[model samples]
Target: MRVSIKDIALKCNLSVSTVSRALNGDYGVKSATRTSVMKVAKELGYVPNIAAKELVSQKSKLIGIILNESDGDGEARPAFFELLPHINKTLAIFNYRAIIYTINSNSYIRGEITDIINLRNLSGCIVVSVFRENHPIYEDIKSLNNPIVVLESSILTRICSNINTDEVMGGYMATRYLIDNGHKQIGFVNGPQNFEISNERFEGFQKAIEESQLQISDTAIIWSNYTGSGGKDSIHQLIQNNPAITAVFFANDLMAMGAISSMAESGILVPKDISIIGYDGLFVCKYYNPPLASVVIDNAAIGVRAAELLLELINGGSGKTVRVMPKLFEGKSVRKY
Candidate 1:
């Protein structure tokens, strides 16, 4: 019941090879012929057999979307979810499809990534939310023969590309903003110490305080998980230990929101009792009781750029690195002193 390329060739009164070339938009096919073939193929309701195409070309058109299981129960980060649509749209332009694979972080060992690629015959991959630095998976991905683009983690190879936001500058901007507003006793709530972004941001925070000649107290910094509950717990612990702190910088928006909610329950108000700044520039920040001030990363741009880089790699291009800059989104949460 399905129309085939042969059927189109028969209707157009052309050789099967000529029809194939025209349908594929291959070189040597005249523009008029290609247009005619496409129009006729559309009239006949022809659907491409991707499986057959793969068999003939010996290359799958499938692009693997890899995520770490540790990011939480198969659901990707909010930032990653924001990036997905752009990545998918870009891939569709190249006639490629995305297939998601959640790598188990807890039980992962070396060589598993290579096995997955071989089994799927994937044309390329986009890895997201992998936090560990020296994990076996990184080593495996480095040695893979196929093209790959990693988000947030830096792993460069002949076949792989890396992309991330400029986290150090983001951190510095957030801290310096607080310092400029006259908040001398500032606290910093960071994610886990193992994450490279966390360390970079902390360095930025330290730089801002040092430049301002403000004392850095050990009790003013807390390293916690990148979760709302973790943020709530961290704020309470931070305030209890350093009651003189007049402002805080949270590494992410979720934690910042959690801290705000927790502080509200304790009769403390943001920008009134204490000022706050957050990272990740989540859209929901605009709707919060007091709009959140954050360092916003361009998720859409990152997604599109990642897709373009992966396509280039798949087409035999060499690896490269891309770092996007972050912008400060001023909101009502930060009170000007």
Candidate 2:
């Protein structure tokens, strides 16, 4: 049986109007009366009707989580899986709900995103995708009045804020570790050049090489999609063209794991013939035969910060960008010279 406000009002010997105001935290209800109503409502296990509340308040209290399928081939990576639950839990604490919306990079046209938000009546939204500066969605995003938070991209609008792991730092940390181990002939397997993260990480890689005074050949760098197969292809190309390469850095763990198998198939032993390290400290890395070394991006922190920022924006706060630092997880994948 559902417990309604009418039942509580009757028990309290009060009118329905008085009970409604108190239940909704509206002004004019005495503290004692509000407390009594809440206590009785809890005892009766009352669940507020969200539709009714929204109708009365003219607010949806619903948040949209928009993700772009950048890889468009339908192979979705679980990169944001850990981060989303945290965001949902944080929003729930404030009586808000999260709805997921996916956009395909290949199919998404201009103004499509704006239509989703307006039609869904979302109070605000968080976007997680790999978008180049020239992506058409930015025009739609910039014109929105609602609050928005974007993860892992450089796009920022007056109403849109950004949250990301410190990609440059993560890249530098991974590469410097290889350098410290005395690997001079290092190769880099990065993601598609269109993604901002791929470029930022490469910047860090360049910084580390410059600081170490190591001269890396132009042929040593390769770009691919953030997929296992892409990693395998890139590593094979990187090594076959630059056989002097003694170690390599992958922009993601999936690619790193793929490269390991590719090397084994080619009769090259990891850390013995060629050393390697990866990014994205996925838990599965520790279980690998050689244990992958990676820079851990704290997705939990990003989720919490993103939720907070969205709430802040809904409440009329100004938008701002936030960056969480990545930590290095050392493993046995790299060999010391």
Candidate 3:
């Protein structure tokens, strides 16, 4: 005994097609007729079948959130997790629901994105994944007709928009903080060089170093994966290679925490012996034994902007790029001279 549009149509003494058009607010239906149909629908307790409605309208109010599987340790996507609630909240305002689609980097290389979008009838998408510049996924995305918002990556398609943190400024802020605090012999621990973020951060670090009339040794910089364990090894190597180094900037907070634990194990105290700073302003940074200073990326802001940009594209706006600035969070991990 389920209520349907047919029940409302019969009660309103109107044809099914007229009732359907009235319910959807389609043109050619008078305002009074639409109101009467809705009132009759309410009286009959008519419930809509979403799939049937979508099939008739040919527009699914579904948004896709595409994520690339993490490279290692499965904890690399903390920022994406943080963005989920904000993105969903914003999309809900427009009566759209978000559907998550997880795929490997190789899937993009194999060009599986089209199938995923078409199969779900997604009206738009926000991609929260990282891929190298030469990856075939960039070309695959360009050929797509749907609105796409890419986070932490760039694609030069008319239908695609890019959003990311001001990475160069973030790198400069972290390194400059150390230099201003009387630490000249500084070291930098970065993520894999293949990542654009890693290279941009390196550029920022170099900008600060050169501006201060300082020269960094060849061994002062180390590139590693964005993992806690990678941090432990990088800090150990940095200390051994440059005993004169008094401070270091880690590309992410997880690595900074790992480096802290390794230093604790080796009886090398923080701040008293060396200072440390990090990027990505993770929540755990403020609660560590010695709070860690960091450059924070606002994931919530990025999420809202991404959703708005997708809507703009759906409404016929051209694709554009947006960059969120980073904020510096001071903690006890850095000591002033």
Candidate 4:
């Protein structure tokens, strides 16, 4: 048989109201009474009724982890996976639980997110990997009274906080690294335009080129999906259009690896024929043939920080933005020109 607060109260010979107040840690309850109620509750094997507590408190203890549906099929960025454990661990510190919700990237509409929040009675959400600026979901999230924290793309509200790496600086660092090695004829392979990070990185790339007085032909820059296959195709297109380019900077590690493999199939050697640098600083980069140079974002730090910010919002804190700095990881992929 299960034990209830009433059983504990009966065993302690206290009023039900006093027992409840002690169990809930309410102010004005005497410390001695609280300790006595806790001891009796433990002796009786009393368990908390979270659902009932939630009803009375008017807030759930559930935290939603929202991801794009494409992430399941390996079409989205891998950084989110790295972020998950940290977020989960941080939430556990506050006795909160996390639930993941994957929504279709192209098909999800307004009110769908709100519907999910209502159905689950979630206290807060951490949205990851959806980068489109004017999407219907963004509008819905903006109007929601519940707290939300977004990763990467910006969508600020009174209840929403945004967190991202300084992508422009990351892009600049990648480009500047290549330029410092005496490679002037460089190409850039970026992700699709709908993502704000893509544009920010591109801006950094352009800044490096202009400052160095180097010229990049229109044909040397290609915007493609952030996938391995997309990387392979972009490499072929880039090489075909600008055969004189001595180096390339990929916006992500997957594409850089894909391009490397594709180049090998065509009897072209990396660093020997062309140098490369990538972003995201994935773990696999260290093990790849010739290794890969990349701009590293501290995924674990970002995850922990995002979780902390969201919990603050849940507790009636004001919304704010946070941008983490990126560091460069050098590898054998970039050959000095």
lDDT of each: 0.87, 0.86, 0.86, 0.88
| List of clashing residue pairs for candidate 3 | none
lDDT at residue 53 of model 3 (Cα atoms): 80
Flag regions of model 1 displaced more than 4 Å: 1-49, 72-76
RMSD values for the candidates in order, in angstroms, are: 4.2, 4.6, 5.4, 4.8
Quote the positional error of residue 202 for candidate 1 in Å.
1.5
**Cα deviation of 184, candidate 2, in Å:** 0.7
Alpha-carbon runs more than 4 Å astray in model 3 = 1-49, 106-108
For model 2, residues 1-337, the per-residue Cα lDDT tens digits are 8888899999999999888877765434677998898899999999998788888767677888888765624556667787889999888766678999888767788888888887878888998766666678877888888889988876677678999999999999999999999999999999888888999999999999999999999899998888889888899899889988999999999899988998898898887888889998987888986999999888888899999888878766778889999999888899898
Total backbone collisions for each predicted model: 0, 0, 0, 0
Q: What's the residue-level lDDT of 45 in candidate 1?
A: 97
* Cα deviation of 52, candidate 3, in Å: 3.6
What would the TM-score be for candidate 4 when compared with the true structure?
Answer: 0.87
Tens digit of per-residue lDDT, candidate 4, span 1-337: 9998779888889999999878865434677999899898888788899778989987677899998886424676678878899999888766678999988867887799899998989989999775576777888888999999998777888899999999999999999999999999999999888778899999999999999999899999999888899899999999999999999999999999999999999999998999999999987888999899999989999999999899889867888999999999999999899
For candidate 4, the 10 contiguous residues with the lowest summed lDDT are 69-78
Ten-residue region with minimum lDDT total, candidate 1: 69-78
Residue pair clashes in candidate 2: none
Candidate 3 lDDT over residue span 127-195, tens digit each: 887776666666778889989999877664678999999999999999999999999999999998888
Q: Pick the candidate with the highest lDDT.
A: 4
lDDT of 1 by residue, 1-337 (tens): 9998999999999999999867754434577888898999999999888678889977687888998877633434678788889999988765678888878877897787777778889888999775567677888888888899998887899889999899889999999999888899999999888777889889989889999999968999999777888789999999999999999999999889889999999999999999999999988888898999999989999999999899888867899999999999989899976
